[model samples]
Target: MSTLTTANPAYKLELTSSPHIHSRWSTKQAMWMVVYALIPAVIAAIVFFGFYQLIIISMSVCVCVLTESAIKYFRGREISIMDGSGIITGLLLGLILPPNFSLFGTALGSVVAIALGKEIFGGLGFNIFNPALVGRAFLQATYPVPMTTWSEPSYAVDSVSSATPLSAMKFDAVFAGKTEMLLGNIGGSLGETSSLAILIGGIFLIAIQVVNWRIPVAMTLSVIVFGGIFWLIDPAVYPDPIFHILSGGFLMGALFMATDWVTSPLNSKGMWIYGTAISLVIVIIRLFGGLPEGVMYAILFMNGFVPLINKYSVPRIFGEAK
Candidate 1:
């Protein structure tokens, strides 16, 4: 009888780690997309403020890119300024600044944003706070007068007060109409005046899946629910919920800064908690605190708790023991 020969397998199994599926977008793509999303705000800033605002924006971006490049060179790491993180930080800082802020101060803020806010903590992905906010906070402490000064937009009419909406409400008890704020006719930071422009960019980001929708939704809801309560208690004393949503930097901060992938929470549950806490703090500070605006402080404060939020909020692996 003829013996049958044993057959060898056609393919061999190879073991691999998790993350079997990969995203099509790279770090550079994500960073640049953020820059793209902010472009509408940048253009709106220039349109509302003036061409001088472009100079400020340019100065901030150049300084941020240069600072990051210098640090990378000194550390013997390959310079990756083109990766777009520096551009984003600078762009954001520029957007939030006073229209005609001194170039020197703008440069200093950009330096601080990249150095202390970013590279000191090991660069882009590792920074604890939003880099732009860090720089803004520094400038706020160092140059209080310049940072607080507001200017009338180029197209502003005599009826449109130069005082920022929040400032007007807080100090003068003057309510800037909802129509003016929505159309960006109110005096405010370069990029924060227009709810319309911010909404366009924010919605684009959310639609592209670049941003988590939960944080913004949670933050907006928190503001409406809490702000509404105060308004109902005394409409004369407290501004309405829509005013809270459209005025100041609430939309910009909720959509752009607080949703930062690095500083924000990871899981869905954690995002809701983080967003709610931020909005609550914002409400407290805006209504009762000495400051007219509290978005920067609110976002930075919540950034500190992201690690803890992630730790407890991670979902259990499927089919694993409790």
Candidate 2:
């Protein structure tokens, strides 16, 4: 009989490894904090794109959670839908997607992100790739027609024939120096356009200690420094380094994707090199390579080399064997 008693209850519950796991910090709480951190971006999306932003975000999250749950059930594993990882992945994916994307495609993206991006790599912390980017890349590769056709923040379906600013830069040289590119009035994926929103959220995460400050600082500095020299030499070709720093998806990738704790280098020196290399790759891709927005690919490319970075770039410990 389970009865309430002041002195002694009818039974004493046994506890295990996770008994005291949640001490003021929970995965759910942490995820919600991430959601809270995303509030500014959500507001920006809604203010620009209207209430449809909410619909897209909701669909992204719902599909991700449902897919995750279905996987757990089919695999005969404990339910983990409440942990909020699926929610995070969905939100990140939605933010990166073109706002005018098909709902079916969005759902498929969530499923792919979970099943291939995460679970197949042994789930969450063990994944070799960023699940969100994996889904984005998959869609980009498979459906270049819809995936590349970006639209400005518009409520009309007929007006969805815009190209992303990065694509524009890659294709149209005449439209390179426009303010719309930096201020996010241009066509692109929802979150990638607004460097302001990404910066605000990144700062919040850093202030709250939810994210480290190293990666963003190093990467941004590298891009600006490298791009600055070139821009100073020829403004006709290179936009302001500030524009390069603030435009497209650099902040979003540096702050969110490159800073993934599991995939990024653990030590300080390795972190600096990791972030710098990513930034250099981003610049190379944007300037010398084919891609206009290189953040996602740069992070994915470097994530493949994290283990090697960890091994070689690790600073010698105090009084350690040489």
Estimate every model's Cα lDDT from 0 to 1.
Answer: 0.89, 0.74
Cα error, residue 78 of model 2, in Å, equals 1.7
Model 1 poorest ten-residue lDDT run: 1-10
Q: Pick by lDDT: which candidate is best?
A: 1
Candidate 2 matches the true fold with a TM-score of: 0.85
Cα distance off (Å), candidate 1, residue 234: 0.5
Candidate 2 overall lDDT versus native: 0.74
Q: Estimate each model's TM-score.
A: 0.92, 0.85
| Residue pairs clashing, model 1 | none
User: Against the correct fold, how does model 1 do in TM-score?
Assistant: 0.92
User: How would you encode candidate 2's per-residue C-alpha lDDT over 137-238 as one tens digit per residue?
Assistant: 888887777887666666434432266655655666434444555545556777777667777888988887766688888898898888887778877766
- Indicate the residue-level lDDT of 315 in model 1: 83
Q: Please list the residue runs of candidate 1 whose C-alpha ends up more than 4 Å from where it truly belongs after superposition.
A: 1-24
